[model samples]
Target chain A: MSTNQIFIVDDDDAIRDALGWLFRSRGHVARLWSSAEALIAGGEIGRCGCLLLDIRMDGMSGLELFEWLRENGHDIPVIFLTGHGDVPMAVAALKKGAFDFVEKPFNDNELVDRALAALDIHHQRSSRQAAAREVDERLAQLTSRELEVMERVLAGQMNKVIAMDLGVTMRTVEVHRARIFDKMGVRSAVELAQLLTARTPKPD
Target chain B: MSTNQIFIVDDDDAIRDALGWLFRSRGHVARLWSSAEALIAGGEIGRCGCLLLDIRMDGMSGLELFEWLRENGHDIPVIFLTGHGDVPMAVAALKKGAFDFVEKPFNDNELVDRALAALDIHHQRSSRQAAAREVDERLAQLTSRELEVMERVLAGQMNKVIAMDLGVTMRTVEVHRARIFDKMGVRSAVELAQLLTARTPKPD
Candidate 1:
């Protein structure tokens, strides 16, 4: 399967086969694993796709793998394939960053729908990361003094106060501020702050 | 006071009175409070505005007021006013839902600028809440059966499956789904879900 394939990790052979057939019918591909260990052995970490993981398996429960993925900073979304009794654990996983959980005896369409939403979330997070990286690159283009002025400006410092703090003339501070704004592509201090702190809370 | 008023709460008359003068000269009014008790007495909890609160005082500290406001679901943005030793407390307040904190002896311009940003956050949050309320109102227009169909549709149920569960024909389910899309002003199941869950997170 390609990197975009949905990775299914469940010890139940029937579930794995059923999910594989369901995804295929829906014009998508799924890579099924009999266990979490088999999934790890597949060398699919860091890929940009969703994981449909069974909550309770013989070994390495879904929650453990969820924590492990978080610690590794892998940006993939995870959907827990949980049974009815596993809901509290699934809710806890949701708090810890799992995308969504589907109970066993779930509607096939419901599972697929959630998988689609999880994929969208994954793309959004990836795009935000890319945008942040681009912003950091632009930020690095400023001179050291300009960077200082930008920080003070975002801190709501006036030109005179910034000049005094940097031991420079008010005109000099203004010059640096103008250059910083130009390089940062922001017209005002508020816009600059918004750009610098672009990491807003994502909708769950 | 104008809608842009910075509501100032401080036990020290000196600080409250000084800030009142500072905000006035900056073309914004200040609603001064001698204590958190007086602030609650003023009955301004539900208003959309920015709060400038002294982090430490004799009774009902700013942090306590912050917690109370949050527990009561007050949507106003709070900016803590802190002394040197109160920095850590102010930091904790920020984590606990404060917009930002200004340290003493803070520059007048810096404090006002922060208050302006806090007001913007308040407005954004209010707008998001308004949008959510509007969505809820639209949802209320649906018939009981249409509502059920919508729930099933959003859960990723197929028309045939929904019809089977509801003991209706597939054509009837399709008709209900179409009416749901029309009433909700959404084009697809994904769009409908997004509209229904359109609550924006508050800035931390």
Candidate 2:
């Protein structure tokens, strides 16, 4: 796994510096931002990493920032730092998919452990999404003729019928079939069907 | 991810045949057993992929099989197939780390979807373990003296201190440090330390 860049968004200079020093001492690179605007303006969201966000800030609350990020399609995993009165808000944020929350004056180890786990999960989700995109790209590699044949194959159609429907010879269909299998890394038509079905976009 | 061989242990021959056919049609190899003893006798536990087990079998119930597998250190993911009355048992199995449970007469699409998700997670976990092993192997390549220097570097020790502790010149420590960075694919000690700590074993 790659080393993650942690962005800490907190208003208090003391807390920011303390946490930053703690992370640095533990061999982690910590970037501190005093406001959500600074963090967003920094353009670090697209990069694979996590956010350590304070629940209450001067201008933009952590929950508001989280909602903003979500509305803008930012998928970075967030660990919210909450105070005693903010626990309910934090719990609500979790229901909306905040990774985890740490109450004020939390054990350093506990916070770091949750941050690390969130980072791991974030990486895994990114990798899975990448893999899904790769699958889509590979599926795109087929020619239109091959795609038609693939659809037929997925529909449990035999090569003879596919060839007849396309006004092609059985041998030609077989060749295209082989190419499709090779491109998709599938052994049999049934497997290809399953993969195709899984990747097919569903109607909302 | 490497494909896994699923073992389906259920007393109902209909259910067994249906699941076996489902997996086989999807290009996965499945072994169906009517009882726990039969599954155990078939092969070593390590060779088996995940287990699709029924909660209520005549001889050995799914819970018993799970307990036995845990006692023997067989850590394969087990997804239980439960009847209408077996929801509590299914929940208990999940608490014990059984992957997930589906009730009898479950939707085929939902069941397969959950199975695929579970397999993906297992593959990721296995991949992480392999990566950790690779890290261990690379660390092993370092000589005892090199290991000492690397540890000191990870601890954020100065080159002069590391040299003094290892009874080497500062230049020698610098040379070893460069090699360590190159070998670990890290630009700095903090990055290397993050990689090392990321894979550290944690108590459950």
TM-score against truth, every candidate: 0.48, 0.45
lDDT tens digits by residue: candidate 1, A9-75: 8888998899989988988768888887777777776563789999889888887887877887775
Off by over 4 Å in 1: A1-204, B140-145, B171-175, B182-190, B200-204
Output the TM-score of candidate 2. 0.45
User: Could you give candidate 2's per-residue lDDT for residues A22-57 as a string of tens digits?
Assistant: 888898778889999887888776763788899889
Candidate 1 iRMSD, 1 decimal: 20.1
**Candidate 2 off by > 4 Å:** A1-3, A71-73, A84-87, A164-172, A185-204, B1-204
Q: Flag clash pairs in model 2.
A: none
The best candidate in terms of TM-score = 1
Candidate 2 chain A least-lDDT 10 residues? A195-204
- DockQ (Cα-based) per candidate? 0.02, 0.02
Q: Per-model TM-score of chain A alone? A: 0.76, 0.78
